[model samples]
Target: MLDNAKYDQINPPSRLLMGPGPINADPRVLRAMASQLVGQYDPAMTGYMNEVMALYRGVFKTENPWTLLVDGTSRAGIEAVLLSVIRPGDKVLVPVFGRFGHLLCEIARRCRAEVHIIEAPWGEVFSPDQIEDAVKRVRPRVLLTVQGDTSTTMLQPLEQLGEICRRYDALFYTDATASLGGNALESDAWGLDAVSAGLQKCLGGPSGSAPVTLSARCEAVIRSRKCVEEGIRTAEHRDGDDEMIYSNYFDLGMIMDYWGPERLNHHTEATSMLFAARECARLLLEEGLDAAIERHKLHGGAMLAGIDAMGLEVFGDRRHRMNNVLGVVIPTGLDGEQVRQMMLNDFAIEIGTSFGPLKGKIWRIGTMGYNARKDCVMQTLSALEGVLNRLGFAGPRGAGLQAAWDHYQREQPS
Candidate 1:
């Protein structure tokens, strides 16, 4: 029989989120999200919108004026960038190294793009020459890839790809969801034409908002697909003659008008998420973006050291790994799910299982966002040690925590 029970007001368990994403949001970001709402056209609301745009410019390390929030999770930003510029049958080249790369290909195919792909093994990223060779062969209209793929715990080197795309007359884009705030991503300096990221990772915010930036070239292509909604159309409103975007909500051109000086009504913005995104950027900028990235590197390295000392093998190339997350191979004789369940049920901590090809092979642990701290690292490592020991997974007792402390001590102990 179904237990049709009434639940009390929103009580929830407190668990340290040490997984790949959706970690505990920063307290400051939560406070910002709790603020009262205002009308979309309210001066204060519009001012906040403008400030969000400016703040994300710094967060994304770009001077492009199109930097703004997409009022959905990270993939919405990816869709917006892809569907805005990709015409039916337009050639798009995607390099697949992990699950999210497959996501990029899927989104592009839905946009009616003639998608081409180059791939690497799950734990490896494509080299510049490999991508350049594909670009030269495909002569694609756009080249899309992921900056960090949490599924395999690898970060593709993007600094050189941008220049390669330009040299080959192809536009460049990357989904920076797993890496943006915790890793080094130089949007303008790297020649990136489009970059999209979510606030849930190293920004220490919830997962609703996605911030995106576009170079002038990318913006021009989007403007070519511009179509103002009939209800809000003014005499001065002009529609671009190119292909109309399939998605009304994901349309970047109309969204630009919504966020631009025109103050055009597209969709009612998610006010709380806007506040959260703003606060996330404000917090990051206050800490200095470089400093925050270094902090992730610090905690991430400590976690890696602890895992390694416990005799767990990291799943990918160490040189190309993102500083925020890593994949630990499940021990030979233990069920991965049992270990994760014990960590959660007994220790009140949360970590992630891998996806796609890596599914059932590894556990993805993250040191990012508000949870990227020494205490969190030590606690998670220690708890996993306890779980593994009880399950008869062998490694030295107390060694993991000691190794993590030694790493902190050797670097910058505070």
Candidate 2:
């Protein structure tokens, strides 16, 4: 089974990632990850863990003391929340907007919850009243939604949904993986009970870490089901009536104890990924969250302008598009995958394609995290124009780049 002979040292080709996520991380984050590891119990390591918790509070725009890092990717964070809070037969409502909405439903179903789903067409998001109406009727224990779904390149508006959930006495949770840092997410202000995100997108890091925040209301639900494992239970303990969380690694209660004042042992802690996550939050706070959002908006706007000028049709409702990604409708008579291959082979640039029903019909272009810059937008547009022309889909040579430049010039303050 081994194939060591065929593999070489880790030299990978350089590519400009202009897609949905896993965009190039900030250089400082990588540098931090390279530092040597420390023992899990080491004072310095635990100190960094605490700092990470505090730093992410700012990043998430929350004062919730339960905010902490999950040892896996964004989906891990989602599962952690769902598994800990949702008991068997509990009703959970997920409004399907795109692929990730379906993902939430799937996970909740696996957890043995009674999953109810409402739907909108792929490119559209539900209005606040629509979600509230469902909340009133279904009356789910949790209302699960995604802030941004890369598959559709649409950002669902959450400011109103939170209040709706509170009015109906339901917990509100959102997967902010594609929107956090690059977009506005106010956990406390929005009244969100819990929020989860990944480092691969606007956080400027890879996919190994997930930063999650939980409001006190959500924490109470998780803590109610807390069960100290056999190895960690003391003589004074008694099990609670609530069911134990199904997964050990994703048990947020245990995870919290590890990150909290007790410093209870759970796993050994992913030391390098912890560093990367910490540095991501640090960089974002240093830049300021508002400024980061503005950066994504500006670069993303430039990309839209470039695509528009290229005579390309954009997919989805323009009013609901995410600030970090674009869904460009593949031109008729052009082979979509063929164009993607040329972009990768010749330009060494990576863009994304859609999933589910929209697959093969659109290309997802992202300007996010460290790659959300004037240079990245211009380069991607130029390369894409070249490839399109070469494929016999002819347009003016410099129209794409010119449009992006003009947008930048117009937006620049005097």
- How much lDDT does each candidate structure score? 0.92, 0.92
Return the lDDT, model 1, position 92: 95
Model 1 misplacement above 4 A: 1-5, 226-242
lDDT at 109, model 1: 89
Tens-digit lDDT track of model 1 for 1-414? 755577556878999999999899999999999999999999999999999999999999999999999999999999999989898789999999999999999999898899999999999999899999999999999999999999998999998998898898899999999999999999999999999999899999999999999999999898877454544544444343237676789899989999999998889999999999999999999999999999999999999999999999999899999999989999888999998999999999999999877899999999999999999999999999999999998899999999999999988956
| Reference-based lDDT, residue 219, model 1 | 92
Q: Estimate TM-scores for all models.
A: 0.96, 0.96
Kindly list the per-residue Cα lDDT of model 2 for residues 67-157, writing each as its tens digit: 8989898999999989988987889999999999999999999889899999999999999989988999999999999999999999999
**What C-alpha lDDT does candidate 2 achieve relative to the native structure?**
0.92
Give every collision pair in model 2: none
**TM-score of model 1 (CA atoms):** 0.96
lDDT of 2 at 36: 100
Kindly report the root-mean-square deviation of model 2 from the true structure over all alpha carbons.
2.4
